[model samples]
Target: MLQFINPLLHKVIQSISPCVLCGIDRQQHHSLCRDCWQQLPWSKSMVQRQEIDIQVACHYDYPIDRIIQKFKYEQHLHFQNLLAGALLQLRLPKIQAIVPMPISNERLVERGYNQSLVLAKMMAKALNIPIWQPITRLQQHSQKGLSRLERIDNIEQQFQINSTSKLRYRRVLILDDVVTTGSSIYALKQKLEELGCQKIYAACVASAEI
Candidate 1:
């Protein structure tokens, strides 16, 4: 009976944490206020990412853009549930695990968390799938300032698969916060492909069309 209260306590603690999107007492909407809850984007569209099939949940505009800025730069993590809900709009493919694009150690330390990882966990919970952390960033650099070509070039060799990670699954879903040139996700996807990950699907909150 020692662990019986554990679930109760967890539920209580979660109940008290106010909604991040609207700062309300609404617990039913995954810590999002009813207004913000209704604003969720629910569109599934195919993305143009070379030969690999990609899907995006939203158009990367307005409130999502603003909230994503706060979520990343402002260190607001409570929006994870909201972001996860946004990602659920995508038409999921058959995959065993949801893999988040990893951030460099320096970025993780500076941010105190990896936004992609947070989103991945939320996605996994919503999708009823497992989370895999196979992709590792070997370099410590921000992709925001880099141009498309530079991002493509710089991302090369910056990511490598963790040999210890059990990635025997044939299909996997990749998650990212924002996609610009699709370079970073591409890099991680390539590494997974080399490791025998045959079918890959990717999802992101926002995609920049150039």
Candidate 2:
């Protein structure tokens, strides 16, 4: 009874609430009104990055880019629902679990959360799958002056297997808030492969120009 009532109550709240973007129209799609949602720089396509084809929901442009920056850096967690909704727009594959892009302990301490993990929690619940974190990320350093190869090498070293967990999933999806060069995803993928993931897939809320 509560389960049924919860959804209906949510729908009612959404119907009355103003769109997060326009702040005038009633919420329609994913906390946005019909106009705002349709205008969201949608991509809904696959992008090849580091030989991996990632499913992306939007082009990292306009309001989407700004929203992501706020959600990740500014602690505007209220935007998470809209961001998770964007990922839900993708045609995701069937996987046993979701692996959110891991952040360094240092970064987590500074930011108070791993943005990808927060989004992954929403996705895992919606998809009825477990959230898996088999990789731990070391402290991240800036790549401001590094060459491409050096940047890749630096990013690759950040991901280390979390040896404490014996649990492994043959199939999983890597969730990230954004994708640029895909260096981090590729690095993470290598680690997932080491863990014996047979069919590893990746998806992001938005993809930016490399």
Candidate 3:
């Protein structure tokens, strides 16, 4: 009884406590104060016109980095809600499924969970879209300093389509925590295309560029 009461009492106290990111009274469902949120650099708009339309969650810098680090490394699952809310700001097109990039089994064991998957799940729930886990990883290794051809070559035959027939003609929105050189998502795009997904879009929480 005391243990339960103590935790509840502490939560009540925290409810009124000042926000860590911004010096303001904390509010439910708000991790940082409005000032902090506004200060953080996010894409002015989610949509970026490209061959394949993509939706970006936010720019990868400062406060966003801090949040992602906490969410991924520290296992701060509560950040999912905050991230999902931030993601909703993006004016993404209607998506049939949210596809998360799958990590290798070795990395998954080390991390104990996939951050992209959690982000995708939250986004799917918020958007009322199905979360697709049919994508399977084909290869794993450090991609540093690899040429464009080398990177593409490395991933060839690495990812396998779980069931292209089932997902044929459905729109796929691929989610990733970060994008560098667009290699990772490129591989996913090829795999998704092989699965016969009609319309495919990529969404990354952060990109290496502004």
Number of the top candidate by lDDT? 2
Q: Candidate 3: minimum summed lDDT over ten consecutive residues — where?
A: 44-53
The TM-score of candidate 3 is 0.81
RMSD of each: 3.2, 1.0, 4.7
Order of all candidates by TM-score, from best down to worst? 2, 3, 1
State the lDDT of candidate 3 residue by residue for 1-210, as single tens digits.
898999698778768866656657584444555677677678734444224456676778888888888988888886776677677777777778888988878778878899999888888877888888777885488767878789777765567777643645468888887665666677778877877777888887766562
Alpha carbon lDDT of each predicted model: 0.78, 0.95, 0.74
Ranking of all candidate structures by their lDDT, best first: 2, 1, 3
lDDT of 1 by residue, 1-210 (tens): 869999798677767776666676655565666677677554467777645556877767777888888999898876787788778766788889988889889888888899988988877877788998877897656667776778777886698778887657788988898776677778888888887888888988877575
Q: What is the alpha-carbon lDDT for the whole of candidate 3?
A: 0.74
Clashing pairs in 3: 138-158
Per-residue lDDT for 90 in model 1? 69
Clash count in backbone of candidate 2: 0
Judged by whole-model lDDT over C-alpha atoms, candidate 2 comes out at 0.95
The best candidate in terms of TM-score:
2
Q: Which pairs of residues collide in candidate 1?
A: none
Superposed Cα deviation of residue 21, candidate 1 (Å) = 3.8
